[model samples]
Target: MRQQMLNNGQQRIGKGLQLSFVLLISGALIVSSCAKIEPVVINEPAYLRVFNNLRFKVTVDNQDQTHSTLVMLINPEYDSNGIPAGAEIIGDFLVTRNSYAPPYPSHIGNSLDVYNPEYPGKERVNAGPILNGFDLSSWAQVPSGQHRVAFYSRPRSEVPFFNLEMRYRTEPIVDTVLDLRAGEVYTLHVLQKDFNTKENGILLRQENFHKLALADSLVYVNFYNMSAKGFFEAPHTVKPNSGNHLLGGLNLEYDWFQEGIREEMNVFYVAYDERFLRQHYDGTIKPLASFMTHLKRDTENPATAPYWSLPLFFNAQDSIRSFLFQEFFFSRPGFDATPESFMIPNDGPEGPGAGGYARLLCYGNGREEPPAPRRQNYVAVPNLIVTTHSGEHNPRSFATVNSIEIVNNSVYLTTVQRVYEPPVY
Candidate 1:
């Protein structure tokens, strides 16, 4: 009986140990399952604010000639299915062909659209309230980093076609990569290199839009060389003088040759001198001789008269203190004299004067004319556009800005209307 008790005690010990082992495993599993998984806190991604400075009128092949309008922007990122991320409608401006001018006709429309990636096909969300042109005042926040930018030209009627197939169906007329930084402002200028062809392009310019501590008595001016070919020739010197020449002709050779788009050249700081003010009023301060260029249309003649001078103007009204130099075309005449003129039937060639075709007129006589060549004279004219801010208390709140654009063979200045503000993304 004692031996049986010993065996029973041993069994009871064994059972206790087994029970402990099982309990230990069960406790471990319970701890593991009930343990809280700390929720992952993901920080919001940073963004880069980008502004569109592109403005153009597009003509669709199948669409009405009068209804020519096309402008589009696309984000080149792709999803799991390899579909285009989406597109943002920059501007669908209707071309008002009022007259046969070189610049063609100005565009007028405010409607812009952004494609809805979540909902594909025929669905879109308005980017913002209808903007007159590409919203230069506002910005679009894109995730900061490397991104591909694409531009397309299509009829306004086809904006509903937002699928990957449709987005790339026509091929992007302008495709480029942008290494965008967070919290920076960049202006993307899309220009129509050739209005007749679909060869469109983009030019990028960064700007500092911070408020300035500008003095009322002083004005600041900078030269944005849009005349790519015109600058090829050496510029003359101009200096300030007692005569009608406000700033005497300083050799601008160095100034003109300074290469790059929107390069930082000599920024003129003009004090409100009485003489300069008088010139502004009397319009006597024409471009100095040094500022003039004797551009030759015919390569044969080594000598030609300087017919055109870079157009310069200044405005000291209220908040805007600026000096503008408008050099929209090549100083050389007849290179691409208005496109409309080409379209118009050439009234027979080789006529000397009026009605009669002069051989020397159509084509140069291959002889260098004296100072101020007597060939057809073409002058650069200044076109001024005034805009007012509705809600601003400061009447002179307008700021100075500039841009370079290529439409066909013409290079002109595009006004940057607004500066980029913060809290965008």
Candidate 2:
């Protein structure tokens, strides 16, 4: 089977079959906000600024299970036949900042009205909502970076709701660039700070509260080998029901039959279904307070890996026409805010939508650009930054400055090009 498939791959490569795919990257940036100061009482001030907007090019893989398997089966139960269907995913993910900021308002309200800290308040009427999910047609254009990207997911019960407590995996911050395509779900959540604007002002700051999802059913990953000529294609699919089967012990055997294959070869693929178990939906999986809590506790059991593995699949075929099928089934429907439902309260920084950031920024080079993404083409999560006082308010206008340059964790004095001063409102 392997020999036949490899031969088929060679032929496909000869024909230049471009195999489509996807990947995701996470990174961070250091930014400082400059706010106008008015004579006011003092406190330990932390400035809220627009850090670079993170650009993640997510590429979905068919074999790399370690990073793709966000959830896996623990202990499973099967009936007379073996058919995997459901399992709870338990693992941690990382979040990072973007290199470019989208056209969205800062969660903080505009100057005329103050944003409410507790509630998001009414979304602005004039603002057009920005879709924050996946874009497949142009996954190859994302640049490289070093930082973290936030991860989020909706629960099985609440398809319309986001920000499930299981969202926001924080560890494993730094890594290589990511490539993303269709037939995958990428969660993006934001984190920012909010301040109490004096007055009956309603304010909103981009907090880590909002969670988003990029629901791409089939993404294409492109492979490059400068040394090799022609393009090759090998189609595969992520087994949504891999580890979780139906009432019997019967699991699904993925089948691929193409037009060019010889009749002598069998089309059977072999990879253990370990991603889900029936017990997950039956209330056997325990929910923890957070993934960090799971990581902190010490436990030894060979049955469980220290972290959850990203789910991936392997496909075997000797045919040239069978295209890959990647899909995430929904027994329930997904929800999103309409243009009317997406708005920021008055009194905080105006969001990109309100400030005319609803479309992708034009990087004009005299080239005709692609069309805008369709509304149904993407998903967005509303991120809200939250804050609480940890120390007494210092009502004095005194300033303290410190500087040092570090080389290999060692510090040295250096001249300053700019000084950071917090915004005082």
Question: lDDT scores for all predictions?
Answer: 0.30, 0.19
lDDT of 2 by residue, 1-425 (tens): 43444455555564564421110111111111223446432232211221111111134652211122121111222234342222221121211222212122333254443321111112222221222331111111111222222222212222221223323122222212233222222222122111111011111122111132211221111110010011001112211211111111112331011101111111111111212322233434322111110111111111211211111222343111111111110010121212222222232222212211011111111122212211221111110111112234222111111111111101111110111223454
In TM-score terms, candidate 1 sits at: 0.38
CA lDDT for candidate 1? 0.30
Q: Give all TM-scores, in the order shown.
A: 0.38, 0.15
What is the C-alpha lDDT profile of model 1 across 1-425, one tens digit per residue? Answer: 43443455456675786655555566567667877967332233222222222233233543333222333444554457654455532332212111111111122132253321111111222221112322332333445566566655444454433442444435555678767565445545444333234344555544443223432232122223322222222121111010010011222221111211121111111122223443444533323212222222121121211111222224434343222322222222222332112121133111111111010111111122212121122212122222233343322323323332222222233333332222222
